[model samples]
Target: RTLLSARAPVTLISTSGDPPLHIAAERPSAAATLATLIDAGAPLAMRDGRRQTALHIAARAGNSVAVATLLGARCDPELRDRWHRTALHWAVVNGQLGAATLLVAAGATVNGVPMPIKKHLKKTSLPLEAPLHSAARLNPASGAQMIELLLRAKADPNLRDQFGQTAMQVAQGAGWSPAQLSLAWEQQYVHGLDYLRAGSNHSR
Candidate 1:
């Protein structure tokens, strides 16, 4: 309130190069303040030192409230960072289920395509892959729920990664049991039909 009353610049970059909105998105408790800053005309498209939008910070922080607030403000959930990964990519990589859920609900693509692999890439470069690929590479027990969620959301189980491996193949290589893989396939089968039905009805 004091900052707003003082008419301070909400988009001012810190020495670290992050604006107030990016900082706010990193804190779950600061979600309301984030909304306030947005209303005060904080630039939603403002990127940090790493070229990450506030939405990427919020999702990677697992700050679901901040993610929700930003989504409500209609921020670009599809915005990619320096590594060319979307907020959904960060959410799944960090196992931030709530943030991932919110992004998916807000129409973030489940089958996000990976950036082309370049030769002699830096070791710190993040591998941009489909959200399902990230979920598959996670611990099988923990990633099962995320995989189910994405599958239910109509993610393509057959989508290939940069290595040209399908998510199920990735899951198998990541040590998922035959039974677990079977269950995921079944779930995908059922939900995929529902998605097709929904699309067909909408076209009618």
Candidate 2:
């Protein structure tokens, strides 16, 4: 705060190439600091060495407060990192339910958008899959809640990835058979559709 008050550059890069806002975002309790940096004119869209904005870092860390702070500041929720993953993707993959919910509410796309993959450059390059695909890869018993949340956000279960596999197929490949996964979520599925319908009606 003192440095900021004295006009310390909020955009200063660390040795590892993270800006001050990006660094502050990694701290769960640093929402206030993040606001201060934003007020001090930190670039909301600035990317670090990882080519991620502060929003991506916060969502990956499961920092709901930080996610809210950035979202409130109108950060582009759909901004993609080097891997073409949005903050919503990070939240789902990391099992950060709260952050994922917030991102969804803020209008991140629930469907998979085509993202070019450079297979030769990065071994971790993900298939062109939506956040639900990441959720499907998680342990079904543990990941049911995430799938529910995504469903509430109207994520299409039948949406296919670059490999022509739907999220259900991905989950099945991960050892969660359709019957097993469906049984786990059967009761909640209707409720999710009801909620989604309510939201759509309200929006209309």
Tens-place lDDT per residue, model 2, 113-188, is 6645455236455577888889988887657788888887788876667776666667767888656677545664
Error of 1 at 198 (Å): 30
Model 1 residue runs over 4 Å out of place are 119-124, 190-204
Error of 1 at 78 (Å): 1.0
At residue 109, what lDDT does model 2 achieve?
A: 86
lDDT, candidate 2, residue 167? 69
CA lDDT for candidate 1: 0.81
Cα lDDT for residue 8, model 2? Answer: 78
Cα lDDT for residue 166, candidate 1: 69
Instruction: Give all TM-scores, in the order shown.
Output: 0.84, 0.84
Candidate 2 weakest ten by summed lDDT: 191-200
